[model samples]
Target: MRAALKWVLWDVKDTLLKVRFSVGEQYCREAERIGLNLKPVEVNSAFRQTYKSYSSRYPNYGIAQGLNGHSWWTGVVQDTFSLCGVQDPALLQTVSHNLYHNFCNAQNWEVFDDSKKVLEACSSLGLKQGVVSNFDKRLEAILKSCDLLSHFSFLMTSEAAGVAKPSSLIFEQALHNCEVSATQVAHVGDHYINDYLASRSIGIHGFLLDRDNKYNQSGIVPKEHCLNSLEELPSRLQEQMD
Candidate 1:
């Protein structure tokens, strides 16, 4: 005797979608041209580490009393480069941000093949769809730019929801907006802890999407059901409906 499914919330970023950046060694060549010994791997790693740390802390420092206003990703790029021994922090910061901006909204970011095909199938079958992300204000613009914003009925952002994931409030807000109860929803995200564990705590069914199967979140049942791609979701849901 299992529960029926009704609401479904999906994570953005690496779950249902992935974004591309810097074509044909653009930035690596540019960094060298600027007289900095930078490799694509170094820049990529630095940017990613910086983004993760700052995005995690953003809402905590954002707009609180006496908290100075700033962008987290900007700080991430700046601080990461500084740690790597860059002297001209401002110039490098500016260039890096421009590079990251170009990356974020570029025609490069896209929904995965598995996600798109499954979503189209699910939508055709009328699954309530919503999106939740631990992100800043640019979410709407990014989604719209990528032609993905309209597919969702609800979008919960860290900035907009006044909190990030692992906080049930944001998930609750998403539930309210989507008109779905926790018992009936499923959330999919790349991170095991935030996307899967948090949703599980909210009494919702959850999915941990591991494309490479590189990471696994503890305490989930039926690992086979924890998909490697969204392609399996439709058939999986059909199994449930059976």
Candidate 2:
């Protein structure tokens, strides 16, 4: 039954690796470096609000509306600080620029301890792995700096695909790029709707990585499809395929 699954697609953020610093802490650090005294907690809250607003109004980094990752994220940073009462356009620009470039390197991210093991295990099982994430073009650089880029045969980012999660087009593009049938692949990610439901909607086996037990009682995803850690993945795939 191992032949039933030929590929394993993964989601990057929150599944494989995550930003090492909290948005609030990182933003404050950058802001403080420019001689601005800001509270991390307040900055973080403002960032969350600004992020949700941006995601709703301009999904996929506004790729559909002709905005790229740099433009979209720059707007977010500028507005996040604006919400915090930083009215200096020059200050906003400087902080946003610093934060944007700061995120594209390894110092900004930390790989989950279980991630490498799972990737290696899947490789040993003869399964090809690739990325399907809602990240921007900077993902390749970030992954490379983290030493995780070599594992995947391909990387599909929403900005590059011109489509994002919760939309089946990105997954379809991933399949097309990999030249594989939906039945031959499985996708693992942390978001319930974007990762699990989205991939499954197109006949791909979907697994939800619930490292924090956030979905333990959501009653939305099936228990079998939910994993506490990626370490359960290879064995879980075997069980499902068998």
Candidate 3:
């Protein structure tokens, strides 16, 4: 028989934290504040598109990787601003960079309500909680500051693992951190292709968490077992208990 899962690993960002669009807003606001004469919507839209493009281009690198991954997004903003006939690329990037950096270390870290509820339940049931994410190393400090550190057995990031998701080695490392075999742990995440399918490929239980209605576009619909919020996990546990 297989071991009942003793570990619960988290996917950071949208799964646990309420992602804010404020950084994008701040970029536009800063631009306007200094007479850049650009529309906020344009700035925000460009940032989002560029952000996805950058992430798609480089999955392994993150924020502290010296803007190596998402610099393209910043470049998009700069280029667009120039196209819109705005002067001062340096000021725009500087303010935007500061806003992004400050957001990374912000004290008012917004956490998902579901994340708190389920983590509490897991603890009560004696499951070792952990976080494994494709994020920068500063994730540790952010978790610590948000009071999420203590709840986690260990926080694993791409920087520490030296690899990103959709790769088997990272999942293997996450399992090792929890001292469990792939068959024994379940990974819950928002991205179906990256987190769910990747982990599932390696024999771990992978659950797709649909928060922003992403499943509709993922082309791989999540099953009923793939929940919308962590609050639903207790019923699964309750059924197992029964």
Per-prediction count of colliding residue pairs?
Answer: 0, 0, 0
Q: List the global CA lDDT of all models.
A: 0.70, 0.92, 0.70
What does the lDDT read for residue 35 in candidate 3?
64
On lDDT, the candidate that comes out on top is: 2
Pairs that collide, model 1: none
Model 2: how far is 102 from its true place, Å?
0.5
lDDT of 3: 0.70
Candidates in order, TM-scores: namely 0.78, 0.94, 0.78
- Candidate 3 residue pairs in backbone clash: none
Tens-digit lDDT string for candidate 2 (1-242): 33378899999999999989899999998999999999999999999999999999999999888899999999999999999999998999999999999998899899999999989999988889999999999999999999999999999999999999989999999999778789889999999999999999999999999988878678777788999989989998886566
lDDT (10s digit) by residue, model 1, range 56-134:
6655436443232235555665676665567696667665666566555736676677766776777776677888887
lDDT comparison, 2 vs 3, better candidate = 2
Candidate 1 residue runs with Cα over 4 Å from true position: 1-4, 21-37, 48-70, 214-220, 240-242
lDDT for 190 (candidate 1): 76
Residue-level lDDT for 130 in candidate 3: 81
Backbone clashes counted, model 1: 0
